[model samples]
Target: MKSVSYAGLTFETADEIADALLQLAAALGVNERSETVDIPVVEQNGDLSSVQLVIGPASQFISKPVTSPYNEPASAEVVERLTYRTRLLDLPRAAAISDSEIGRLDFDSPA
Candidate 1:
């Protein structure tokens, strides 16, 4: 289990979810973007809840390991979604240049 502190409030979630959330936040920060996401978390009373987090370039988070007996919230879908979004944010969206295109450009260039 991991405790993620954001906006002065702490929420507990699975280790993978916490890690994925951090990664997504970094990606969003690098891109100077923001997003609202709902993450499955365990409340202090051991009840399941989905907390909405608004993360962006200025967002700050603190994640730490925590010992909890309650079964880590099953949030594979959340983790997968976060991972996918993080990867999308990290990808460079420029068009790909083929080897032939590069060769043509090289030949057309002045010596």
Candidate 2:
């Protein structure tokens, strides 16, 4: 049987994970839609062994208020200006040295 684990919880199958997320959302007074939840999943058959943190669907455990710099208009404007000014550096040309030139150069030269 496939299994997924997060925080201190373990869930077997996608349905169980969905139900658990719904319960968690309900506990936190947040409405969870069946179609909206995007749970991190990995499928494997046999005894429950591997475990990982669920990222997308589980937001109930986040104690701190999530903030984005882009959420603010000023920050977004600054980011946009910086991004617009950014330019890709031109590729440097490779040195074209012949075997005769290699022999002429010192084998041990200090930088």
Candidate 3:
């Protein structure tokens, strides 16, 4: 388990979930974007609950190790979605142009 501090509150959740959430937050920040996410958490008495967070360029998060006996929350789908969104914001790369294409461009002019 991990303790994730966001907004003004701290919540306990699975290690992987916390790590992925932080990573997604960073990616969004780099792209100057924001997203709302629902994270599953374990309450103090070991009850299951969730927290809604708005993460963006200005959002801050803190995650630390915590000991818990309960099983990690089932959140693989959430992780995958976060990863996909992060990938969508990847820096643009220049497209590769072939020598033949370059030659065509040089000769193709409107008369």
Candidate 4:
């Protein structure tokens, strides 16, 4: 198993190191192509060791959208209409009714 050690703490796997790096990136709001993490280690005799971790070329969570011929971009109006339709569909039937119409409901009557 690959591992990295610094400041008396040892990360015993690449996954662990990657997770830590991701957390660090999130905390720092790092959305750039790449980022470096420097881990400083100091020994009892006052010797220092620097461990560098190169994060990445922007993980998928922060990566920019790639343009492709297969994907045609939609106009702002179209996007807004689609979003509005989706939100309308997501609402409960009762909530979708207008407030003025809601007062006309016959709660004492059975369906």
Candidate 5:
């Protein structure tokens, strides 16, 4: 239960923010070591302290191909067709929280 230190929200509600952070932590697969990191949250449409738990470390993550290696490289047109997910947020679980300042974000969905 770590406290997120950010000044984006107009009003700070520790309980709601904490719950959202915890949910995001599990979805992002954060372990015991990842400290809070800046993440894109759907608030005033800016960055916020979502969580430090990332799918992979920066080095390993940046090296991966857009598509799997076994599969042939995607054509330029095919690559253009790809779009990132933005609405994959879990609503049912998040409903319990009523933090208007924090807003709702599909934290786990690909940016």
Candidate 6:
């Protein structure tokens, strides 16, 4: 079996990105346990919610190049590996959204 993961992010910039990702995963029958979802929130006064959520795989795999006599190939599988991770909310320097908005930080598709 192959191991892969998906991440779902939600921000004020757009309402459909997270929803689309969620749809993609569900349409593909992605194992919920394998996917991680994180949504960091900020406030207007440069304050943040005391609660931060981070969910993902236990660990990630590193890729190695394969050299073959006939051809050189990279890892059989891989995805965009993220490093120096952070949320864009910090840059906006906006204050926290309404409590209602905070609770709405889920990827929900419209029927």
Clashing pairs in 3: none
Give the 10-residue window scoring lowest on summed lDDT in candidate 6: 75-84
Tens digits of lDDT, candidate 6, 1-111? 111232342222112322333343343232323344332223233343222224333323222222222311121221111111222212334567898998877758664
Candidate rank order under lDDT? 1, 3, 4, 2, 5, 6
Instruction: State the local distance difference test value for candidate 6.
Output: 0.30
> Could you give the candidate ranking by TM-score, starting with the highest?
1, 3, 4, 5, 6, 2
Residue lDDT tens for model 5, 10-110: 21123333344434444444322233333322222222323232321221111111221132222333222211111123233433556874577677889
| Candidate 4: tens digits of C-alpha lDDT, residues 1-111 | 123443445433223333344455453343333455554433333354445655444433222223222322223443344344334434555437888888999999997
Model 1 — which ten-residue stretch has the worst lDDT?
A: 101-110
- The residue ranges of model 6 lying beyond 4 angstroms of the native Cα positions read 1-13, 24-33, 42-111
Q: Could you tell which candidate, 2 or 3, scores higher by TM-score?
A: 3
RMSD of 4: 19.1
Give me the runs in candidate 5 sitting further than 4 Å from their true place: 1-13, 30-111
Error in Å for residue 41 of model 4: 1.2
Name the better of 1 and 6 by TM-score: 1
Model 3 has an lDDT value of 0.87
What is the Cα-based lDDT of residue 75 in candidate 1? 75
In angstroms, the error of model 1 at 5 is 0.3
Q: Is candidate 3 or candidate 4 better by TM-score?
A: 3
The 10 consecutive residues of candidate 3 with the worst lDDT sum are 102-111
lDDT (Cα, tens digit) per residue for candidate 2, span 1-52: 1233446664343333434443544433332221233343332332323234
Query: Which lDDT value does model 4 have at 17?
Result: 33
Q: List, in order, the clash count of every candidate structure.
A: 0, 1, 0, 0, 0, 6
TM-scores for every predicted model: 0.82, 0.20, 0.78, 0.23, 0.21, 0.21
What is the Å distance of residue 39 in model 5 from its true position? 9.3
Best of the candidates, TM-score: 1
**Model 6, 73: alpha-carbon shift in Å?**
38
Q: Per-residue lDDT of 42-63 in model 3, one digit per residue for the tens?
A: 9988889999989999989999
What overall lDDT goes with each candidate model?
0.92, 0.37, 0.87, 0.41, 0.30, 0.30
Deviation from truth (RMSD, Å), model 1: 5.3
